[model samples]
Target: MSENDIERLQEVLRDFAKERDWEQFHSPKNLIMALMGEVGELSEIFQWLTDSEASHLEGKVKNRAREEIADVLLYLLRLSDVLDIDLIEAAHDKLEVNRQKYPVAVFKGSSAKYNEIKD
Candidate 1:
């Protein structure tokens, strides 16, 4: 229930883990592995469910999915911190690069990667 900046939120999480001496377990490689595991957990929620069925779980079942997703974010944030990656800055930078590679007119309706555009 706090309106904090991303850095503040990350600090809070880091502090919580530090309080439990969990930082020793948070190496960059381990954090990345945990992030992947969390992603798999989140994916399990809709593994076989139809889009309509998955959509219908918006209220109750979503809690499980949210928990898994939160885990993914937590580990990703930790990984970014450990690797000295500024996620927001990197995201903004990548957005600009992607725009060059995938101009809006070419990518607005398609999911193709940069090299897929017809010359």
Candidate 2:
């Protein structure tokens, strides 16, 4: 999604919390804990799937996976909001760092960590 989309979602979440008087409960720590919980739930959906099964979810499984993904994203966006983080920019910055660390010339098709790759 674009930065504008993220900003819009953040505004919506902020308003939702305000309407429910939930801002008091949306501290960074609380949001992070909730985010982790959602991630675990999402992971559970694929825990038993083989590689092919995991890659190609069907019908109800796909729907359930989508819901879990949405939950994870909501909590993540909320956490970013609480932390005053611009996730889009942060992601771009991290991607640049990753490109430097995993240069394609040396790391293409390789699963090794940066430190494990020899010159």
Candidate 3:
């Protein structure tokens, strides 16, 4: 997604919380906890499923997963807004860091941690 999408989401979330006077409870810590709960709910959707099953979720299961994922993202965006973080810039910076840590030649086809990968 583009930066505009993130900005729009942030604006929507900000207005949503403000509309209900829920901004008082949307502190960074509270938002983080809520985000974690949504992530757990998302994980529950895939629990006990095989890799293929997880990848090929159907019907109600997929719908539930989608809702849970959206919850996670909404909370994350709200938290970022509260903390004045630019999520897009942060993601780009993190990707650059990961690229340096996980060079293609050394990390290709491997799932090991960067430090564990030998040159």
Candidate 4:
């Protein structure tokens, strides 16, 4: 919800890794690979769903989706911690760049890539 929330989650993840002696294996490359795996698992859940079906997930499907999302976030947070990157600030910075690249007046309701948006 806030930067403090991200920090708290990062602390919990740090302790979790330390307790398990997993810090040795938590390199950026390994964490990014694990994060990608979790993302693939999450993608699999939606692979067969129609647009409408995907929008309204529920029951076991939703539970599994949540678990996969948690896995992805944990790995991502762990990776960011190891790299000393502020994930929230990085996200905010990226969003600002995107806003400039895709100004609403020219991009609203359009899904074109920034470079492809014509005058």
Q: What value does the lDDT take at residue 80 in candidate 1?
A: 80
Write down the lDDT that model 2 would get. Answer: 0.93
Error of 1 at 95 (Å): 0.9
In model 1, the Cα lDDT at residue 10 comes to 82
| TM-score of every prediction relative to native | 0.87, 0.97, 0.97, 0.97
Q: Please state the error at residue 51 of candidate 2 in Å.
A: 0.5
- The digit string of per-residue lDDT tens for model 3 on 41-98 reads 9999999999999999999999999999989999998999999999999999999999
lDDT of 4 by residue, 8-105 (tens): 99999999999999999999999999999999999999999999999999999999999999999889889999999999899999999999999999
- How much is 116 displaced in model 4, in angstroms? 0.7
TM match of model 1 to true structure: 0.87
Model 3 regions lying over 4 Å from their true place: none
- Taking the candidates one at a time, how many backbone clashes does each contain? 0, 0, 0, 0
lDDT of 3: 0.93
In order, the Cα lDDT scores of the candidates are 0.83, 0.93, 0.93, 0.95
lDDT of 1 by residue, 35-101 (tens): 8888998998999999899878876578998888788878877888778788888888999987798
Q: By summed lDDT, which 10 consecutive residues of candidate 2 come out lowest? A: 32-41
Q: What is candidate 4's TM-score against the reference?
A: 0.97
